[model samples]
Target: MGELRLMKGNEALAEAAIRAGVDAYFGYPITPQSEVIEYLMAEKPEERTGMVVLQAESELAAINMVYGAAGAGKKVMTSSSSPGVSLKQEGLSYIAGAELPCVYANVVRGGPGLGTIQPSQADYFQSVKGGGHGDYKQIVLAPASVQEMADFVKLGFELAFQYRIAVLILSDGVIGQMMEKVELFEQMPRMSDDEIAEKYPWAVTGKKKGAERTIITSLDLDSRKMEEHNHHLQRKYAEIIDKEVRYELIQCDDAEYIIVAYGSSARIAQKTIQLAREKGIKVGLLRLITLFPFPNVQIQELCKRGIKGWLAVEMSAGQMVEDVMLAVNGNGKVAHYGRYGGIVHTPEEVLQALEEKIIGE
Candidate 1:
């Protein structure tokens, strides 16, 4: 109802950032996600909303820039594919170490090392787990459609500011490239400096007259202080786990089996559920929307409902399934199935895998 338009997922992300009142965007262009920046450049958010969009020379530079802006209480963001995101990990870690608020996106592509430009969920471990070195967690949103790709930008910023931590929108090439209808939100005014000062009293605004200078850094040379900081981060992560578990259930009331997936794989699983239901298979679909906070509680609740088994269908060799297995914890069997290295699994193939791996076997 806001403004409906057909848009590629990446373009939708750009428009959403503009309307989200983001202060800055600093990122490098990479395949499958380059449209994010291309759309921003063409639309010129500067003239529209005073948003500063800069294409950094490298992913490393871009992420560090994000760190700087976010430390000063500005809403900043960046986007990249797998490899490009890898290059930004150190900066991301630093941002996390300092407990900064910023948004990032990884339009994931196949990769162990530049494997392919095609979409893959192989980055699951990196996004949900700590990709950077440390004991920190990021709030990760997995968007299943172009509309979500747009909507999550606003949500991501909200979460980032709410918790004063990094947030990630984990998309893959499938959604990044696919065209779909999206209803975009109305524009939001950029936050003023006075508002930032009122909101983020800890931010490095500058040395005030006869006031203590604010220092922001992740570094605490003292081992005791470092341990305390880590404990603080852990507590924050636990709070997020308690409050931010988000997922969608499809035909799960009397389900004997459930297929677990996120993003594009979840989209395909919707169809697979229909096919299985037609064959009298009481299968349901659990589409996970937040990967980091993880829907472990939901899965456990399903186990309580007598779900016999689960099939984790993703675009990876097997990652999220491990988490599912942990959540199930011998309550039921958990198996993984997917087409890897950029090949998408068809609804029929997923149905077959579900039948063979958990049902038929």
Candidate 2:
């Protein structure tokens, strides 16, 4: 346990990265998330913990820097908003193909283009469904609070290294900009060359005496070899799905109606549940913490328990609802309610939709 302090989500995330022993951070400035790098620069982790921080010329350059550092077996990270994250997709695909471990955060804004600087979960599909090319998956974690914003950085790094895969902390403007009390972790020292060698033996660090040189690249000219690599990735993803499904079920016992949400929407849905309960409506909430794993089994089990209906509340039109429907598998009716273009839905609006669309019908 560490000291508790009131902080913004972006600041918490940056402090947590320092405490998580990140070796380097390479990122470009982006709205609702610029505070992450700004804090890192002001803290001067280079002096405090020997951590390196650099502002890249562009998101493309930042992600490629991450790829390089991660390939060298260092704990590196980057952060950006939606459009910037989109630019990093190519680098992300390369990192996944090379099987490098790193953490990235997308403090998302509303988007199809350079949407708005306000909160949005429209990037859910992109984050979970392989935003870049190739058949690959990145572990996605959604934080509903400033505390989880800090906590998930540690968890993200742990998972990234454990599976040798990229991990995404998919937050939005609401969570990133909101202020809250957060308890941060203790400071951790950066890893040394010996530590990296012991931990990531296959890393493309310089070869030891009599040891074979290691190469890190995603390029495979042979089709059969590429297919084999894809199969291996699939196996790794399946294992991650089986082992790392994380979510929170609030007031679910004996409830007839359920609300499915993640990130900021989960916080809003919590209030909706309270309001609905006051009216004697039995409603519960399923808050997804690990979005990539999807928590399908938990959702399916809940659906099997004979819930009347599900309403997926999001900041986007209807991205995550598709996953909810897939999990429900026709067991019950599922509906989606959202506000787009940088707009956030109010708790009252969510409750109203729940009543009209799910409870009333």
Best candidate (score: lDDT): 2
Q: What is candidate 2's local distance difference test score?
A: 0.95
For all candidates, the clash counts are: 0, 0
TM-score of each: 0.99, 0.99
Error of 2 at 132 (Å): 0.4
In model 2, what is the error at residue 39, expressed in angstroms? 0.5
Q: Per-residue lDDT for 334 in model 1?
A: 91
Model 2, total clashes: 0
Q: Each candidate's lDDT (Cα)? A: 0.94, 0.95
Candidate 2 per-residue lDDT over residues 1-361, each given as its tens digit: 6889999999999999999999999999999899999999999999888899999999999999999999999999999999999999999999999999999999999988988999999999999999999899999999999999999999999999999999999999999999999998999778898889888887988988898888999999999999999999999999999999999999999789999999999999999999999999999999999999998999889988999899999999999999999999999999999998899999999999999999888
- Local accuracy of candidate 1 as per-residue lDDT tens digits, 1-361: 7999999999999999999999999989899999999999999899998999999999999999999999999999999999999999999899989999999999999988988999999999988888999888899999999999999999999999999989999999999999999999999999999999888987888778998888889999999999999999999999999998899999999999999999999999999999999999999999999998988888888999999999999999999999999999999989999999989999999998998999987
RMSD of each: 0.7, 0.8
